[model samples]
Target: MCFKHDRAVGPLIEFFPRYCIMPAQIISGSETAKAIREEIAAEVARLKTAHGLVPGLVTILVGEDPASQSYVAAKNKTAHALGIHSEQVTLPAATSEAELLGIVADYNRNPAIHGILVQLPLPRHIDEAKVLFAIDPDKDVDGFHPVNVGKMMLGERCFLPCTPHGILELLQRSGTETSGAEVVVVGRSNIVGKPIANLMLQKRAGGNATVTICHTRTRDMAFHTRRADILIVAAGVAKMIKGDQIKEGAVIIDVGVNRIGQTESGKALLAGDVDFDSVVGKAGAITPVPGGVGPMTITMLMKNTLQAAKQAAGIE
Candidate 1:
């Protein structure tokens, strides 16, 4: 039985009969995200009433990629729902790099727009690095700016990359202990892996863990994985980690979201890096694919935007 953290429960042992295996506790990202959104909504209300400040977020989409369009739309809708001044700029595929940079500059200078996010995977002609560098670090709520990245490395107070930040939130809210724990992250991507590894090693409330990151070249992936007290898998492959690779009672945070196949009605079937069925039985707590880290990523972006707005208005 996948026990949700929010529901009332008696003794944990009572739910499992003698000789029967107990399923991993389900760390519901959807429920956690909802609770965080409520907190943010309350804070937004207070910020408006006390200081007359409303958070503002602007998301820029360079092309007509279906996935990017949908992601940007969801962000705008969430911003509006939270009483933020949300703006969506949809440019043609042929939009010049110079023109895009100019738009970012405009938002950077505009005091009303506290957060600016440029959707990733720009068109072939555009230099992705140059576009990211053009964004003012203070307004880069997506936390992709070099300045923000550097500050994050130094453990300074800067907007963290949303997905990694969300992972930390999940660990924190789920009551998973990180201090001195063995954390093995199975990817080195900048967005998720590197940042998360850095976060896990930092001397903070959600950190102070011994972290090891595995990548494509790792010779013995299972060896390292088996040693982990908490395993974080972000490799894009579907169901890569199996039951035998993890330590017993390890906390599993699966970050991979792959479209494996479609359902009978034509909906996409999603899967994570860690094989859910095989690992769920051994894990002490685990996050499910669809309702896991995905929702928390957008929620953290909203959090960063709110923080940016507060900083701009000189309101702590």
Candidate 2:
């Protein structure tokens, strides 16, 4: 059941109707993230000029995993391009948990490094929690430190997790009124779903939305999704949410990036939890798989690093 709303976003928006097929506006995360990065760059320049402080981000990669290496490289490249000092610390897969903790401790006490990010999926032998706990909360731009998490839970000033914060930015920038809206998140990972749900529930801008989190044990997933005014899917299963599963004119945010298969030439391709083609007409607005949540994640990391730098420099 599609309802008509005054959405005058013609230049960069589309509205889907019930009787016929019309694509909803495609929320371009790439475009949003780029705009944000540019803004952050300007701020970085100002910080250097007025306060003589350069925001520095040090990303610690614990293994030679190809995907992790690529992600860390992309983050470092973006940080430098935005005028933030970036460093990469690579540790062999066999590095012990204690050794990694020592490195984290060194950076924690180093005033030059504002943000310390330990890339996820650390080696099985390493205690990831111990390493995260070792980083000073002020330098924990990844928002994994217990202190930061506690502050966030209490609605205090704190660095937010990148992926979830990115999702919040997308909703706010895209003109989605999260307050009082019915939001359904289809995952429970600490990274995306849990944080997003907590964020949306907060009584803040782009928050206060009635949210429901569904997981594998959900008896009827489609029932909850169909009721959402804003649906955020991070189930990690490619193309899990189909067209008919969503309500007409619902806004969809896809956070899961899974490689379903390959192209005809055997090149790798990615897909999202929400079926893009199928949900195109069903949703009021939706994000594309690759260009959706991916860009925003890194951009938010930059924002966190900038904030950390401000804190370090004693500049509110």
lDDT of 1 by residue, 1-316 (tens): 5344344743444565443467999999999999999999999999999998989999999989999998999999888888888998999999999999999999989989999999988999999989989988989898888999999999999999999999999999999999999999999998999999999999852689999999999999999999999999999999999999999999999999999999999999999998999999889999999999999999999999999999988888
Candidates in order, TM-scores: namely 0.94, 0.94
In candidate 1, how many Å is residue 66 off?
A: 0.6
In the order shown, what is each candidate's alpha-carbon RMSD?
3.5, 3.7
Q: Which window of 10 residues has the lowest lDDT sum in candidate 2? A: 9-18
Stretches > 4 Å off in candidate 1: 1-18
* Candidate 2, RMSD to the unseen true structure: 3.7
lDDT (Cα, tens digit) per residue for candidate 2, span 1-316? 3334445544232444224456799999999999999999999999999999999999999989989999999999999999999989999999988889889989988889999999988999988898888889999898988898888878889999999999999999999988899999999988888888999999853599998999999989999999999999998999999999999889999998998889999977999998999899778999998999999999999999999999887897
Can you tell me which runs of candidate 2 are displaced by over 4 Å? Answer: 1-19, 264-266
